[model samples]
Target: MIKIISMKEEHIPQIYEIEKSCFTIPWSKDAFEKELKENPLAYYIVAESKGNILGYAGMWKIADEGHITNIAVHPDFQHQGVGTLLMQGIIEEAQRNHFIGLTLEVRESNIKAQNLYKKFGFVNEGIRKGYYQDTGENAVIMWKYFKE
Candidate 1:
């Protein structure tokens, strides 16, 4: 059974691997460490089964909003509901903290990810030109509002 739990220091390596595999401009292990240890606003969670981590998600609580920073599932675990589980976990955390909304920036060309965000009640709000450094791809800004 896959379990969603708070991310810990020990999980950074595995999460880094997933980040590397999933993104062209992946964050470094040190960055993850800093976020876990120094960033008071950051919240992260991992999906694990038995002893292995399958995916991870992270967000930053800013004011009354939760900004999703990253969400990635291991290639082998893709399409097995890991992403959905991660999204649920993150959204739950936001709601628990009384966040008024959740926001994320996704690559405009990543239709699959955009669709997933839409399924979770996130709607396209705007666009960011050249938001991705690796490919100079535009980003689709999405938001999920919990209240008026």
Candidate 2:
């Protein structure tokens, strides 16, 4: 059984590994630590089974909008509902905090992610030119509106 919960300090190392494996430009450990410490409006959640970290997500809520900062599942755990569960967890958190909307940027080439977001009612808002420097790829910004 996969369980998702708020990320803790001890899960940083494993979360770091998953982040690195998932992205071409992974966030630093210090960055995650700083986010945990200084960002009260931010949230990080992790998925685990038995004793392993399979995936995680981070988001920041500013006023009525929630911006997803990061989300990834280990390569070994992909397609087993980890990503879906992680996304659901984030959505619930945003609703709990009374956010009016949620948004994120997905790599233009990542159709799977785009489809997943679409399934949850996110629509394309615009494009961010060269949002990801490592690959010089454009990002497709997506948004979801919720009841206040």
Of the candidates shown, which would achieve the greatest TM-score relative to the real structure?
A: 1
What's the TM-score of each model vs. the native? 0.97, 0.96
The local lDDT score (0 to 100) that residue 91 gets in candidate 2 is: 95
lDDT of 1 at 120: 95
Off by over 4 Å in 2: none
Report the lDDT of model 1 for residue 107. Answer: 96
For candidate 2, write residues 1-148 as lDDT tens digits.
8899888888999989988898888999888898998989889999999879999998998888899999898999898889899999999999998888999999999998888889888999999999988898999999999976
List model 1 lDDT by residue over 1-148, tens digit each.
Answer: 9999999999988988999999999999999999999999999999999979999999999999999999999999998899999999998998899999999999999988998899999999999999888889999999999974
Name the best candidate (by lDDT): 1
How far residue 72's Cα lies from its native spot in candidate 2, in Å, is 0.3
Measured on C-alpha atoms, candidate 1 has an lDDT of 0.94
